[model samples]
Every structure is written in structure tokens, then in C-alpha cells.
Target chain A: MGNCYTFKIKNNFPELELLCAEINEIARESNFSEQLLFSLNVCLEEMLTNIIKYGYDDNRPHDIEIRLEIDNEIMILTIIDDGHAFNPLEADAPDMKSDLQHRQLGGIGIFLTCKMADKLSYERKDNKNFLKILLAPHVAAL
Target chain B: MKLTQLESTDRITNLLLSGSLDISGVKDVEMDFARLASGKRAVVVDFSGVTFIASLGMRMLLSAAKKLDSEGGRLILHSVPPLVETALETAGLTMVLPVVKDAPDAISLSQLQR
Candidate 1:
């Protein structure tokens, strides 16, 4: 048995603030560690920001659905969007060895999200982009 | 987000940032932060109060740092929460923007001959 929460947000940036606020509350109530909270926020912010920034082709607004589930010791975050079939897993990893002057911040969002979240998988089906991220605690809580 | 700056010396500028540097937080302070960092002095940011950061925050910091770098100045962050520091490190930002233990360590590093 587990708990699941769903959120529907517009394909815009401002909506994320409300979404994160509610998420932070539930995550704290569920005993998510501070580290876990940070990681969750990073993943949400980065992924959704990417989708909002580059996911659409037309000027009209769109809808993005987010599902957060807590199953025992694991946290699963699933984002479903109706944007183009872009797979974040295949996005180019940014150059981590470059000097400051040579560095470009383009690809770091998804790359850092991948590093923070324990597991990530992406798929395109039924004309929707499904991106799932799994987060496990670094240490079992007492 | 809240940004506070200390009385700066001729060689050092100290700023303390509090709250999440997420989307809205970045919007709340990016302009002020950029203006404060646009100096030739070493800019040391106290990051102990920041509870969250994402790539947008990173971009804000990077733009300011890049601008400061072009002007021969630098940005240093200290007292970062562990996981936040890890996120920065994962993106290889801590190299260009050094994260030290405390304000003193950051200050000392800023004093070192470049």
C-alpha cells in the first residue's frame, strides 16, 4: 500500500512555485530527509523547466501532469507531457571538465537531475512523453 | 529569496543569501545579485541559509560570475548545504566558483594571488 498525489500544471514557469510548495509540505510530513527534499526539488525544477522551455512547438499553452508516489522506502516521480517526443535520457551531457570561460550551461539541467535522482527513465507513447524518476534515501531512516 | 550584503572592504564584497534559489527565488534576486557581483572585488556569498538550488540558480550565478570574471573579479560561495554543494559539484561549478568551509576560508582564498 502507498500514497499517491497528482498535480496538473500549465506549461509555464510560474506554476512550479505552487507545485513545489505543496510537494515540500508532503515530503516533510512523510519524513523525507533534507537531502531528499533538495534532490526532489532539483529534479522537479530542472525537468519541468526543460519541458516548459523546449517541449512545445506552438504558442498556445499546454498541460503537464505530475504524479508523486511514495511506496514504502522509495519515492517515484512521474511527469507526463503532450510535447514533442524528446527523451531526456538521450540529451547530451554537458562538459564537466571545461573551464569557466569555455563552459555552457545549456545541458547541465537534465545532467544534474540524472546525477541527483537515483534512477531515471523516459519513454514516448500515445503521443506523450513519460519521464519517471526514482529516489531512494541515502540511508534508512531510524 | 532574500539577499543581504555586508559592509564591503576595498578588496572584498560579502553577500549572504537566504531561501531557495529555484525559479521564483532566482527571479526575486537575480538583478540585485548581478549588480552586487559586478565589481572588481572578490565576492563571497554566504550560502548556509539556502535550502534549495537548481540549474536556473546555477545559470544566474554563472552569468554573474562570468561577467565578474571578464572584469577580473570572482565569486565564491561558502557554508553551502552538503547536497546543494554536491549539485554544484556535479555540474563542475564549484571549480570555477569555489565553495569553501566558512566565510574566513572563502576570504582567505580570495586573498591568495591569482
Candidate 2:
């Protein structure tokens, strides 16, 4: 079994970068590719930004916990935050082919996260939102 | 994010953007574009100061630029740093948008009908 790491951070955007940077370092230590690291960063940013924006009411601070587990060349990221129960997958997706004049921009973050991650799941348990994302190593070229 | 603008003689609006382009700053970019859209002028977004861009930020800029493009208006970008330029190019946006070297060059090139 691979080792697991946990981190707790305030629900702030700048602080989110620190979390992402840590993930990147772990990916490096685990020998994951650069592409996988970037994908993780992107997914984490999307999920965290959602919580920081809509999870808390007014200026109340919240705790966001991130867990990293390695399993058979896969990196699993589990993010838990005590914010409002909002499902990011439920958000509407933008039509990428739509003309600029008619295009809407708010929903692309979730869309990108969904596309980039190999596996993604979300749960709202005990008044907390848990989002899990997994990234697998790139298949070696033939 | 910090956004500063310069208006050229040919009525091209050059906006210099810096800092992280993420969900937190997307709203400000949208509002700024909406304010600029009210007028009939070309727009150029300078990415010299930008270091990182998220999907939301890219969508915001693309949506705004498309709006301007539809009304016989022009929108160009310039001075994109290496990392951002690589991402934009890889995403195939470089082909769709004209990018110049500097703010002055973007304004000068804006004169050429696209």
C-alpha cells in the first residue's frame, strides 16, 4: 500500500496554490509525469475555488482537507471541505464550439476537471463535501 | 489580478493584465470587458504580466473577445509570456487570435483589418 498524506488549509485562493504546489512535489516524489501533475493542480483548483466561493456564508472561515494516496501507479486525491452541499458535476457545461458572442464562461472549470482526471467522484457526508480525483500514469509508447 | 488599459489613436483598447487568472478574477475581467464593449473600439489584451491562467479565465477572455469580434470589432493579444504562450498555442487559440510582441505593436497591428 502506498503512503497517504493529509493537509488542512483555510478556504482561500492563494493558499490553494500552496496545496497544489505540495501535490506537485508529491507527484514528483512518486515519479508521476509532468502532465499528471498539471492535471491534478487544475482539478484541485476547480474544486477548491467552488468551495471558497459558495461553500461559506459571509466571511466565516472553513477547513479544507486534502488527502493523497498512491495505489498501483495511480495518484488519488481526496478533498474534504465543510462548505455548502454543492455538486460541481451538476453545473452546466459550456458549448466549446459556441460562438464567442453567445458563449458563457463560468462552467468551464468543472468541465476541464472532469475531462482531465482519470477518475472523479464526489460525496456530501456529515455536512462536508468530499471530492476524489485520480490520475494514472501515461501509458508507455509502443 | 491587476488590469490596466491604454487607448491607441486608432481606438484600440490595450489592456495589460497581471497576476493569477482564476475564478476569483474572472468576474472583474468580465465587468471590464462589458464596460469596454459598450464602446466601438478594438481591444487587445496583453499577457506580459500574466503567469498562470485557469480554464475560467481563458473562457472569460475568449467569450469577451468573441463578443467584440461579432460586431465588426477586433481583439488582439500581445506579449504573452513563454509559459502562457505555450499553453495558448497548444490549446489552438494562437491560430484564432492574433498575438503581437508588445502593447505598442498590438496597437499598431490592430490597424490592419483582420
Candidate 3:
């Protein structure tokens, strides 16, 4: 059986620190290498930041759920949010060739998250956005 | 996260940053970072103590680099940990933001640009 951990936070941006701390603790206990931990941290922060920043249109508070299941060398991360129905996989990739003068800032978050993870899938159900990410051991080796 | 501003010369401004540069870490230093980068000839950020970095942190650096570039200044990063360097490389930011080996190298690189 795999180990499972879940974290729930408000839509507020400040809550990201808490989420990161929890993940860090779990990753350490699981003996994750620094590189793997960094990738996982980046993926979590990027996805959660996107949801918190652009997922909602109102000021009302909402809950975001993150679940992690670790089995052997594979990790499955599931993030569920009650915000807008947005599929990150469908977002346009950033122009990597742009020079410093023309380079865009914000779009790189989702791109980096996608590149670091092994598999990414998105689904919208009952007005909630579900994002599933898989990180295999081989991807972490990079 | 802690941000310490080193001595500023006529051509280069040094900022030593230590800690996680995630969302909160970026927030703690974004304003100060911007304030220091503004109108400066060159900026060297010593990343020896930075343990982690994320997209938010990368965005902060990129924004600062773009701002410096537009103002005829440059931003250089040195002493970056392997993990942080990999993250920057993965995002292809190393092409724009120059990452060097040490503080002296960063200073020299910035000076050469001027």
C-alpha cells in the first residue's frame, strides 16, 4: 500500500506557504532527494498559484484540495478546486525563444510544471476543476 | 526568507538572498528587490544560501532582469545551488539571466556588459 497525504487550503495566496511546508515535511520523511523535492515543490506551487490567482472571479473564499499518493517511486498528485473550469493542459505554451525585451513573465509557470511532471490530465466535474499529475522516478532523475 | 543588501558600487549592486524563494519568499522580497533594481547599472544576486526556488521566484528574477535590461542595466546571478540552477535551466531562463560561478564572476560579467 502507498502512503497518502492530503492538504486543504483557502483560495488565498498566503496559504501557499503552509502547503509548501507540509509537502516539504512529507517529502523529507519519504526520503525524496533534493532534486525530486524541488520539482515537486515547483509543480505544487505553480498549479496552486494558478488556481488561486486566476481560477476565481469573485472575492469570496473557496477551498482547494491537494492529495498526494506515493507508491514505490511513483507519486500521484491530485488537486481539486471549486473555482472556474480551466484546463491547464490546454493552455498555450510560452514562447521560449523570446528575447529578454519581449519575454513574457506569467505563462512560464504552467509550462514548467508540465515539463517537470511525467503525466498531466485535467477534468471538470460538477463545477469543480480536477487536475491529476503523475511524477515517475525517472522524471525526477532529470 | 532573508534579503541582505551588500555594498553598492558605482557600477554594481550586490544583494545576498537566502531561503526558499517560493510564493511567500518572493512576496517578502519582491518590493525590496524591485526597489533595488530600479535605475541601477548592474545587479548581482548571490544565491548561495537559497535552498529552493519556484515559478514565482523565477518570475521575480525575470521581471527584474527585463527592467534592468530596459534601463540599460544588467542582472547576474551567482553561487546558485544545483537544484535551483536546474530549475532555471529547465525553464530556459539561464539564457536570459546570466548565472555564474561566484560573486566575483558575477560582478565581472556585469561590469563587462557596461
What lDDT score goes with residue B35 in model 1?
A: 91
Error of 3 at A60 (Å): 2.0
DockQ of each candidate's interface versus the true one?
A: 0.82, 0.27, 0.74
Cα RMSDs, all models: 2.3, 5.5, 2.3
Tens-digit lDDT track of model 2 for A1-142? 8889999999887788677777767777877755676577677777787778778876977789989887657788899988778777788865555444555556667777777788778899999889888777553311
Error of 2 at A20 (Å): 2.3
Q: How would you encode candidate 3's per-residue C-alpha lDDT over B52-74 as one tens digit per residue? A: 88778888998999999888998
Worst 10-residue lDDT window, candidate 1 chain B: B89-98
lDDT of 1 at A66: 98
TM-score of chain B of each: 0.96, 0.85, 0.96
Q: What is the per-residue lDDT of model 2 for residues B11-113, given as tens digits with 9 covering 90 to 100? A: 7676778876755556556687666643456787878888666666676667667767777776778888775675555444555567778877877787776
Evaluated with lDDT, which candidate comes out highest? 1
**Superior by lDDT: candidate 1 or candidate 2:** 1
Ranking by DockQ: 1, 3, 2
Score residue A133 of candidate 3 by CA lDDT.
Answer: 89
Model 3, span A30-62: residue lDDT tens: 876676677788789999988888999899999
Ranking by lDDT: 1, 3, 2
